[model samples]
Target: MADQVLMELGDRLRVARKVEGSSGAVLASRAGVTQPTVSRVENGQRVSSVEAVERLIAALPLPPEEAERLTSMAREAYALASEGKRVDSGVSLVPDAARKLFTAASRVRGFQSATIPAPLRSSEYAAAAGADSDSGADWAKNLDDAGKSFEFVVTESALRTWPGSGESMPAQLEHLLTLAQRPNVSLTVIPWGVGLPVMPPHGFTVCDESGVLVETFTATMTLTGSEHVAAYRDAFEALAAVAVTGDEFRRVVEDVAADLTRFIQ
Candidate 1:
């Protein structure tokens, strides 16, 4: 994972440099680092200190906005490396390039139009939702890890809907009730009575600090471009605004679980 993050960090650094219209040697000279250090840093063969990270950002001739984005990404990479956790493995690799963004994320915003969000899903619920092959197991494990790593926001529709086994619905509602007890996790339900339109045609998962993963049945789309992310951020905030919280949210879960029992029977 470290190796993957290192390589990914290098790739982002290199991309930022190119986007700034600069050369590696030029950046090294501006940042007061040796050319090889610059090369290694960009290749993930070496980690850069916070000071060095700042210098590299300074070396880029990008506008203040773009430079700040690069700096934030660099700091995230350094922090992940410090923890010895690879940002490029497990569910991180979903949708390919989104892996890099998730590595640097401080928060996550997820919406499930058809099923419960993975992080809030129970082991049984997750299995029932889809196939139980190695990939599914990896996804469940990844979802569990992500739950520990970020602040999760879920819609009410996702919380109540059951797509798999009959018992899975009640189990899923119970599982979410348990997860919501965590300080880091915040679960909200978008009530059926809410006047809001359906979440944009696409299902999107946003990194609180960076990137957006827009998924489809066939392919997962990773969005890192600032403008695109900003749009999704707006959409997330809007969805969050109408979601049910606290006691009301929990009540909805229990009610849904009870309602689902009849189907199973």
Candidate 2:
């Protein structure tokens, strides 16, 4: 799957460069990368980093929509490469890999500082935020699997940040409240004004004890190293220690939803 995606992305890049009448050397120069790097990318081989792929895509004269699409594809390809059955799965890009991990894991631990965890997101919220609604649907089905367990700790800011339209937030928050009722799911919120021993710069998801998916602005990294996964697991435990659950968690969601309703009105 990763190879196919990369090949398709490479084809798109090659075609785009051809359409612009730019040679690989010229395109590499414009992108501030070597010609070989450009060739590697054009041939569907792995490059140095996601940033490198982004630079190549940016150097092209494609439309904004096209550029964004290609960039997304590149991220997914890199993600899959990192998670492939290699000894070094550290810091690779792929949202699909994360989804697969989530689906296969018996336990999922997630900590989000800026947005709702993907599994708990409502379809409307996911669509409005440009997130993969199919992932949300997949998670929704998984939530009913009694053998699987999910634990999430989200910040108050994440709950309050309106990724969708004004009215949509209320529904999203309500959705969270509903999901929190599940016996196998544990949803907690770290409200504002709470002092923390540590601050995680980004969100991450740990699938059982095997892998950790770290979310970043430009790419998603799948870390399979024991030490890296252990570090993230520790961070999650620290965050969860300070987070509110049960009725307190419900109060936070309701308060945010009410505030959003009044603001919209």
Candidate 3:
């Protein structure tokens, strides 16, 4: 969704530049931004800052309505990354928009302290947890996209707590193990005995270092400001530091799954 907005804005800006008979270099000088930045904006690639978009708008010889339209589009493009807008809907409730973020990003890092991360959730698990079962389909498909990488750090308790039926949980755990084996996927688990470096209040996903989506009970907050995103990145790293990965992670999950299997029997 954000990508679409940026692309449209880029197209409009390109047309406006042509109408003004301005070269990319001329526009860059007029906007006081680098030529590459101007090129990126015109190409619909994410810009460094919202200020760059504003400056480009200011430099362009656009009519009042067109200028406002482009400005609006710019805001929407950066709304999740710059303004840190809060959407009332749960992240899972808007699958299409959320899917776009994953599709556009080259890397996605997520930390879940309570529940299974959405991308790693099985359909049955998601349905049992009251999340839209189909919401995670795109993520599952994206696992095959070798160009993108996904990393998830989850607490051991989250894996132990089965939201679905006893029979369903084994499948979910199996799904996690399968996903963990993917070349581009990394699943890490913080064991029960591991001491945490910091306590995170909730789960958050950072997309391509561009924005962080902090998930809460009622709404999801988009923190795109560089500082806020950096903080979340730090938090994720803190959790990942104490988490087990590779064979150790598999053992932890397998241990939980084994216990569950015994209990189910």
Candidate 4:
């Protein structure tokens, strides 16, 4: 298989600039490069030389420590690009990789049209879905830190109708309700059968300004290019816009829980 893994230099640069409130034009002006060059470099599309990247870093005006870290990241990114491809099993490694994304990000966003987000899934439901032992509160622990935010959206079909876990569905719905009440958690359910002009082919999780993790049946892909991250971020925001929440969403949960209770009884 061709190598799909990538390093996150562009994403790092873009995020650092946002944190510093520097515009592309401003960074370009400071770095002695055109805005297009700054844009391209931050998206990891093109850079003429390592010296140019150094100039871009200097433009960020990062403190000495941060600048050095970014320089090292740029080198790793260049190395990865040169190699072009790496293949890994990714099953065992995904959990730790996900943990890293969680710990590093202050904000997280997720979209799942077919199932619940892992962070909000009940232990039993997670197990039913063949998720790792890391579920329920353990998943929440991934977000247990200062200044963290989680926004997740799932289709109504996924939220209320988990198959193969008739007994666990109620508890999972209740768990969603519980997470919905938390200050830092925003759980939205898009109504069943809502027409979306563009339905996402697969679920994805975005970590703050840098990372996007896409889950497949066999492996999880950690995406790093700034352009790709930006695209995922835009998709997340678009989905979040139309999702149902607040009391309306609560009522939907209640309805589902009642239905589940009747079925189990």
Q: Tell me the alpha-carbon RMSD of every candidate.
A: 14.0, 15.6, 12.8, 11.1
* Most lDDT-accurate candidate: 2
TM-score for each of the candidates? 0.57, 0.64, 0.62, 0.62
Better of 1 and 4 by TM-score: 4
Candidate 3: tens digits of C-alpha lDDT, residues 1-265: 8878888889889999999999987998889876656767887777657889989998998998888888888987787554554443222445354556656789999998778888888887777777753345545777788988999999999888866465668888999999988899999999998887667788888888777777666555566655456556766776787899989999998999989967666
Candidate 4 ranges beyond 4 A from true positions? 1-95, 133-137
Best candidate, TM-score:
2
TM-score computed on alpha carbons, candidate 4: 0.62
- Which ranges of candidate 1 are over 4 A from the true structure? 1-95, 131-153
- A best-first ranking of the candidates according to their TM-score comes to 2, 4, 3, 1
lDDT of 4: 0.73
Each candidate's lDDT (Cα)? 0.65, 0.81, 0.78, 0.73
Q: In model 3, state the lDDT of residue 110.
A: 92
Error of 1 at 43 (Å): 36
Model 4 worst lDDT window (10 residues): 1-10
